[model samples]
Target: MQTTETLFETFKNVLALSNKNNDPSISSERIAEIRKELDSRILPETPLAELGLDSMTMTWIIVKLEEELDVDASGISIFEIFDVQGLMDELIQLRD
Candidate 1:
């Protein structure tokens, strides 16, 4: 039952934490750009491929999401996800 806004906020917060921790060395400028993009361009139905995230970054995000949500998302593949909504749906299903 997570709203899109809540999902976006969680995604943003996780990325911000990742940036602060230098887990993958995502620059502050890049984080700002991502924030801007998420606010302006990202939508629930928007294809994840359109976000232009590299595999490493996407993998890190997925790993962080798994930890944060307390779900076993190990089998989920970024390439298999069609959009943000689809990812959200998968996570919801996993949680159940």
Candidate 2:
């Protein structure tokens, strides 16, 4: 099992790449805010919605995960995942 810190970093890195040059609406300040939310002490039960991620951001995240992690996120529904831990769990499963 991946450590919580590692998972957090993984998500953070992917999120940065996902937002890097693709969307103009996700301003630097917005990214910073999102990072700050990720940097917080997130527990397994923490809801993803609390992080201020919308559908578009989630879509970018899925795309980046597929491109960078070599995992197929096409079958995953952004709305189906309710928590940070669930998201990480899904990613790890896909990787395996």
Candidate 3:
């Protein structure tokens, strides 16, 4: 029984491997800003994942979120979830 928390952590570690952890720094405030940006720019059900997100897209999203949120944005596997709330919940857990 893998919990969502565990899945979120996995996402974080993967993001960290690429040096994209919370703005690529350790500033807590910056992380919150990043979350806001994501919320504003990236709609809950944005098809970023399904819109032909190849390796480059994945890398891009990974880098951008990591650079902004300071929290790990590697969880959720956005394409896998059935709805936006599910995806948000996963990311939120990672943020927490």
* Clashes per candidate (backbone, < 3 Å): 0, 0, 3
The residue-by-residue lDDT of candidate 3 on 19-47, one tens digit each, is 33223565656555544544345443555
| Global lDDT of each candidate | 0.74, 0.73, 0.49
Error of 2 at 43 (Å): 3.9
TM-score of each: 0.72, 0.69, 0.37
Best model number under lDDT: 1
- Evaluated against the true structure, the overall lDDT of model 3 is 0.49
The deviation in Å at residue 23 for candidate 3 is 22
Better-scoring candidate (TM-score), 1 or 2: 1
Q: What order do candidates take by lDDT, descending?
A: 1, 2, 3
Query: Hey, what RMSD does candidate 2 come out at?
Result: 3.5
Kindly provide the TM-score of model 2 when superposed on the true structure, using C-alpha atoms: 0.69
Model 1 agreement with the true structure over 1-96: per-residue lDDT tens digits = 556567667766665555544345667788777676666676778888886677877878888988877888888876889988888888877877
Give the alpha carbon lDDT tens digit for every residue of 2-91 in model 2: 555676677776766566646767777777776776566556688888766667777887787677667788888779899978888887
The window of 10 residues in a row where model 1 has the poorest summed lDDT is 15-24
